[model samples]
Target chain A: MKADLVKTLQKKKKQILEIWMEKQLADAGLRDDLISNEELRIQSEELVQALVQSITEKNLGNVESSEFEPVYEILAGISLSRAKQGFSPRETGIYIFSLKDSLLQVIQEEMRDDPAAMYAETIRISKLVDSFGIATFETFIKGREEVIYRQTNEITEISTPVIRVWDGILALPIIGTLDSSRTQVVMENLLQEIVETGSSIAILDISGVPAVDSLVAQHLIKTVSATRLMGAECIISGIRPEIAQTVVHLGIDLSNITTKASLASALRHAFSQLHLEVRKKQKQQ
Target chain B: MEKIPILRMGHFLLVTIQVDLYDRLAVNLEADLVQMVNKTGARGVLIDISAVSIVDSFMGRIIGNIANMSKILDAETVVVGMQPAVAITLVELGLPLQGVFTALNVERGMELLRNRIDLDLNPEDDDDDAISDAD
Candidate 1:
């Protein structure tokens, strides 16, 4: 039994070794000369690839490595000898700064926009990261803000609802958490619509909103106030029982705002007040 | 969406406001209603704002105007359903709906009206009020 166990273990290791050798040889684009001995090549290549992948993964997972720094990692592959890990965010910045510094030198070298030179530059950029490690919270938020700014100019820092009542549109169904930033955009859009539409009614349907604290409720109240000022109206709909409880718990007063069970009900109120009737569910091809 | 109970008050008109009693919407309410009255030819008025979460100073003034409008149109006016929150928001917002007809509901409000005491609420009040106001 002992001898059999040893043989099984050996066989397993041998199989793994063979697999490793095949992978590495393929990666290195090796010909017959590289695999003269299958067992030996397997043993050697597995160790090399393992070492490279570990180093790449370790850098990405390490969060303490300066938040500004972009980490790089190297991945071992069959086609390419290896791939680099993410560079520290800092490193990427540095690479760009350095490239800017080298504008004159690059022109002198007559390699302006040269693809091969660009690839080399990219490879240099990859060397700067410890790995694809965790990013700090600050970095994540900053990155998000940057993305949002690029996406919309209408969005600003304030979350107050803007109303333009004369326009006639009824309800703005807002679903989701109201981060201050998102809240600002919602306010601007709603207010403008209210004034533009001359709508006698508007509803803030937050049924899909998962949670509400004092801050969110406060924002809603502001929007309602803004709407009423224009002789337009505002209704808050989709206040789940849990959320209602939460608002009460937080000592938030929602009394002045019209609260409804759902968006349909809110719309009903709007139409009722406006004495409006339209064909329901118009089908289109 | 807030559902305001829309009932046809007898000879008078009663608007059951079902929202915060004292939200900012209450501000300039008298002017708003007066404009509506001028356009709609509404006689008597009952602003049932029981849905009011709170009442504020600005709204209190508008309520006052509703009662005042009664003299101009020969109609009676009353308000109902004032919530604690409304009183607070009104105070905070510094709104005051003074002299508006105050009632707990349509029953009490209609009881305060003469001649229409025995008659059911008339939808004409609402239609006349809105249509006249539009003109």
Candidate 2:
């Protein structure tokens, strides 16, 4: 009985492919921007070929069986590629469901003479297609997660920069919320820069930071003490009025830390610590 | 009984910790350092831990104790030549070595001690002012 269904699917493969393409192209969720119609046709054709080749009598009902590995692999490839190409999850879902629709139409036409056989085969086919659809969605989500993970790593790497503003002075402007891990990165980079430059003064400008609470205050203190242990004075600048109010309200003791209202004032303090003066040259015409 | 020798350099006592310290050894060193400070009447103490790699909370506390003891005995303590890894470990362990002076190396440590001692000794001369207004 399963042999006859497989044979019918094999014989009507071209018709199934044509109908599937038409269904996909006519769907409102079809994404022409992410994948062209010709590329979509090739993907659909490859998946159909793999599906027909892998279906056997023993495991036709079991989509999770090892016999269906080739079919799953092709489906996974198409789903992952679509995810990376920025296709919406709904669009990818609709792509697989449309194939199911096309196959059922072909099955109904082939088994028209036997109502009992047609009903049973339609149920089996629907179950198998449902499993494939779920697998495709799983792989699509995995691919999107990988993209997000890579972007997060890149952001952390590029965001923290230790700049040597002057001789014996290093500046680190933190631009985001301070967490324990990011604080570790900030301290390591700042301390390393201090050692390399032999800078006696460091200015931590928190101007870009969006908020400050007790946790951030503790992180700043840790950073300051670490710099002190390295024999460099850390001056925290860019204490916005709101952040200052929060710090005072939280009653976090920043009294021991030398803080300035802005980076310019912090630089001036650094110069004084170095016993250096910046004077403008006389104007010449 | 192994002993870490404390060398007297001028008015400063210099200690170089060349081995990873166990708890007992750290306590012994702290005790020995305080006794030596009293015996020598040293005006400054410089500790070079560039060779010591690991520092747990116990070791950190011992270092802090050494600084406190020397402070009470009227000798300023300057911890010098701290490895970056050791400093990071100490910070992570939540021991900031508060009120203890630190320098990059022994030479800078000596300079710091000298500057501090000079400032301490010159207050009266500073008040004496203008060298008696003489040429």
Candidate 3:
């Protein structure tokens, strides 16, 4: 009986491919903008061929067996690529479930004369397709996570920029919420720039920072101390009025740190520390 | 006994730590540094630790102690050439070495010491003038 079912699926592989493609294209969730109809047809054909080739009399009841490895591989590749192509989870899921619908419809027609065999074969085919659907979902999620991880790393790399404002002064303008991990990055970059430029003064401008709490205040203090340990003076500038009020209310002691209200003032302080003056040229006319 | 050599340049004492300092070596250096400050009447002490990589809390305290000891002897202590990692570790250990002066390298350290000495001497010159005016 199982052998007949495998033979029946093999004979109707092309029909299953056509029905599956029709169902996917008809679905409201289909993303015609992301994938062309020709490409979708090729992907559906490949998956149908693999599924029919892997369905054998011995393994028809056990889709998890090694015989179905090729089928699962094709499904995983399709799902992962769809994920990368920006397919929604529901769309990718429907692509696999629609194939199951087409396969069951063919099996139903082939076993119409034998009611009990048709029922049993329908359950077997449903279980096999469901397992394939699960595998596809797993790979889809993995692909999406890879994209998210890459974006996170890029944000970290571009966020912290060390700029040399003067010959002996380096400025780092922080523009986000300060966390401990980000603090380490900010600290390392500023310190490395200080060493490379041999700058005697550094200005940490926080004008772009959205807010400041005790934790951020602590990170700022740590960075200042580290710079000081390297024998360079660190001046924190661009203190918004609200941040100052918050610092005062929190009772965080910043007495030792030389903080200015703006980057210009911080630069002025740095210049004075280096005993250098920026004077304008006398009017000659 | 392996001793970290301390070199004297005029009124300044320079000590370059070329090896990882164990507890015993650090303690010995601390004691020896204070004694040298007393013996030479040095106005400033410059310790270059760019080569020293690892620093525990014990090392941090010893550094603090050295700065305090030299300060009591009327000599300033300036630690120079500290690695970035070492500085972060020391700060995390809660030993900022508050009283100790710091410089990026030996050249800056020397310049800092010269400026500090000049600043200190100029006040004494003003005091001397004030006393002469009183007389």
Please name the candidate that would achieve the greatest lDDT relative to the true structure: 3
The TM-scores of all predictions, comma-separated, are: 0.37, 0.91, 0.91
Task: Candidate 2: give the TM-score of chain A.
Answer: 0.90
Question: How well does candidate 2 score on lDDT at residue A143?
Answer: 79
Q: What ranking of all candidate models by TM-score puts the best one first?
A: 3, 2, 1
Cα error, candidate 2, residue B121 (Å): 2.4
Interface RMSD of 3: 0.7
Per-residue error for B22 in candidate 2, Å, reads 1.9
The digit string of per-residue lDDT tens for model 3 on B45-132 reads 9999989999999999999899999889988899998888899888888888898999999999998887787677777765874686
Going through the candidates in order, their DockQ values are: 0.04, 0.56, 0.74
Tens digits of per-residue lDDT for model 2 on B9-79? 97899999898888888889999999999999998999998798788888999999999999999999999
The DockQ for candidate 3, computed on C-alphas, is 0.74
Cα error, candidate 2, residue A13 (Å): 2.0
Model 2, span A1-285: residue lDDT tens: 546999888888899999999988888877898889999999999999988888876788877899899888998988888877987777778788888899999988887888898888889889999998899999987876888999987877777899999988999999988898888888888888887787778999999999998988899999998888877789999999999999999999999999999999999999988889999998998
Interface RMSD of each: 10.8, 1.2, 0.7
Docking class of 3: medium
Superior by DockQ: candidate 2 or candidate 3:
3
